[model samples]
Target: MRNLCMKVNYDGTEYDGFQTQPNGNTIQDYLESAICSLTGERLKITGSGRTDAGVHAYGQVFNFHTESPIPIERWCLALNAWLPRDIIVTDAREVPLTFHARRMAKRKTYRYSINANRFPDIFHRRTQAHHPTKLDVQAMEQGLAHLIGTFDYTSFASRRSQKTNHVRTIYEAYMTVDHSFSRPGSDDQGIIHTYITGSGFLQHMVRIIMGTLLEVGEGKKSADDIPFILEAKNRSKAGPTAVGHALTLWSVEYEENIKKH
Candidate 1:
């Protein structure tokens, strides 16, 4: 059997998530079924990240081992044929037999989008989280600065989450907007996109951080008080997490050597 690494993009609106669940339809289930249908070989696929329902991905990574003789190009066409319309196999390729998609991943980038308008737009409503209050980038950036180094993030993580270690080092976190109003259908509705890219993330880590920043923007929480929240070791200290619909796994990066022959 040969191991293969695939770069897939999916709209998570219709699926449960990336991993295969007992009964729910998932991205993995469709990919694996497509592979089986084309190659007549049942292979279980593993993904780099397990996003929540309604969460989307542009460059999510997954790996599978199979003895199928289907060409890499045909893999994409064949998989897309049987898979649902929302989930598409953008790229398929052969990789080292030992390459494990989840374990070998070095870093991942996630983008959470928000519509700052009081009235939500009908067209992009599915992807952007709608919030009435104007989110100040300057204030939010201030709170984001507080999340910069390694610290005990117990306050920034979900209380019921199964993760033990609450400490995580954030390489970088920034909030920016695409101000190009020249594009068609560009009302310049103000899309607030938070980009958080790091070596690793704890459960709901990015969402927690986004909530904390939102608090600062709302004036309910002071940017200067961010340090105190981190020390509180209580999840309640942080603001409410943004919905999964706005979160998207942008990409995964890893060492070329780890790609397994």
Candidate 2:
């Protein structure tokens, strides 16, 4: 058997999530179906990680073992023909049989977008979280700065998570504002983009962190409160989970030696 890795991009608005479900409406389900149709074998594909319902991905990666003789370069083209328009296989490559997509992931970056205008942008309704109130960007930045370190993030994770350890190393966390997409002469301030890169993330961790920062921006919580929340280790200590539609799995990183197409 040979292991083949592929990079996938999808708009998650219409699916349950990334993982396969009994209902058979998921990104993984479509991918596996496409593969089975082309290769005539039922194969299970392993994703880097699960993205929650309505959370999109730009560079999600997955791998599967197959005995088909199909050339590696044609996988992208063949898969896209069978997959839905919203989901596309962008790149494909052959990898060592030992390469496991989830286990080999070194870092994952997620981006959360917010529309802080009085009126939501019609074009970005499905892609951005709409928050009408004015936000203190500087305060939000200060709060995010406190998350850049190894810590037990139980406070930000969902109680539903079955993972025993909540400790994860956050290598970078920051935010940026962009007005290039703003309408001419409109009073729109801009879209706020929050990015976080880490070794791994617990279920709903990024969304909860974004919600807490939103509270800081609204002066409901002080930037200094982040440390206290981190130490509390209680789920109730953190802010509400932000909407999933605004969050996107930006990219996944692995060692330099991993071949890419």
Candidate 3:
């Protein structure tokens, strides 16, 4: 058997999530269906990680083992023909049989977008979270700075998470301003982009963090409160979970040797 990896991009507005569920509407379910149609094999595909319902992805990666003689380069083209339009396989390649997408992932980056305009942008309604009031971006930046080190993130994780260990390393966390859609002379500053890279994340971790940061931006919380919240180790101490529509699994990275033939 040969292991083939593919990079997928999807608009997750209408699906349940990435994982296959008993209810049968998910990105993985559609992918497996397409694979069965194209290669005539019923097999499982392993994703790098899961993105919650309504959370989109720009560079999600997955791998599956197949015995089909189809060339590697044709995988993307063939899969696209069977997959839905909202979901597309952008690239594909053959890897060593031992390459496991989830196990080999070294880092994952997620982006959360906020529409900080005075009025909602209809074009981005499905992809961005809307916040009408002005936000203090500098304060939000200060709040995010405290999340850059390894620590127990229980305060930012969902109480529903089953993981016993909440410790995770965050290599980088920051925010940027995007003015691509800003009007010429309006007070609108455009979108607020929050980019975070980490070893791994807990369920609803990024969204909870973004929620707290938004509180800081709105003066409901101070930037210095982040450390105290981390020490509290209580989910109630942090802010509410932000909407999933604004979040996206931006990219996943693996060690160079893992990608080598």
Candidate 4:
């Protein structure tokens, strides 16, 4: 069997998540079923990581082994033809037999979006988290600055995380405001985007970090309190977990060697 690597993009609104679960309406389940239908092989696909429910993906990667005689380039066309409209196989190619999507990943980037309007927009409701209050962006930036280094992020992790090692490095963490108007020159709304890139993330790490920064923005928590929160190593010391709908798996990066054949 030859290993095939694929880049997947999906709108996670209707599905449970990326991984296959007994509930059965997941991205992986659809992809695997499509592959099985096309190639007549019952193979399991390994994704780079699990994306929470309602979390979209722009460039998620996965791999599976199949003995199908179909060429690599045809895999994309073949799979997309069989898969659901929301889940698309953007690219596919052959990979080394030893390649593993999750273990070989170098970094992952996630973005959480917030709508700063008092009244939520009906069109963008599914993707953007509606926070009606005006937030102090500068204070939020101050709190984010403290997260850009290696630390034991137990405080930022969720209770759902089962990992014993909480140490993870944050390469980048920042928030930006998108000045988009409903009409020309109408400053009715602005989109707040929170981007985080790291070696890896614990369950709900990015969302919790965004929530903590929101607390700082609201004067509920001070930027200087970040290090203390980190020192606490307790989940309760952190802010509430942000809404999952606003979070998206923006991208995943693999090492150079892994990308090379």
Using Cα atoms with residue i matched to residue i, what is each candidate's TM-score against the true structure? 0.91, 0.97, 0.97, 0.94
Cand. 2 TM to true fold: 0.97
In model 4, where is the ten-residue run with the lowest total lDDT? 180-189
The residue-by-residue lDDT of candidate 4 on 1-261, one tens digit each, is 899889998989999999988989999999999999998998899999999888899889999988998988899989999999999988897889999999998889898988876668788788889887767888888999999999999999998789999999989988878766344554444778888999999999998999998899889999999999999999999999998888888888888866622
For model 1, what is the alpha-carbon lDDT of residue 75?
A: 79
Clashing pairs in 2: none
What local lDDT score does residue 156 receive in model 3, on the 0 to 100 scale?
A: 98
RMSD of 1: 2.9
Against the reference, the lDDT scores of all candidates come to 0.81, 0.93, 0.93, 0.88
Clashes of 1: 2
lDDT per residue as tens, model 1, 1-261 = 788788888999888888888986888888888888888888788899788778899889999988877677777777889888888878778887878888888878898887776567688788888776656678888888888888888888777778778776777788877544224564443778888877777778888888878788888898988999999988898888878888898888879765422
In model 1, residue pairs whose N, Cα or C atoms come closer than 3 Å (at least 3 residues apart or on different chains), thus clashing, are 96-260, 96-261
* Candidate 1 vs candidate 4, lDDT winner: 4
**Overall local distance difference test of candidate 1:** 0.81
Q: Candidate 1: lDDT of 172?
A: 77
Q: Which scores greater on lDDT, model 1 or model 2? A: 2
* Residue 25 lDDT, candidate 1, scale 0-100: 89
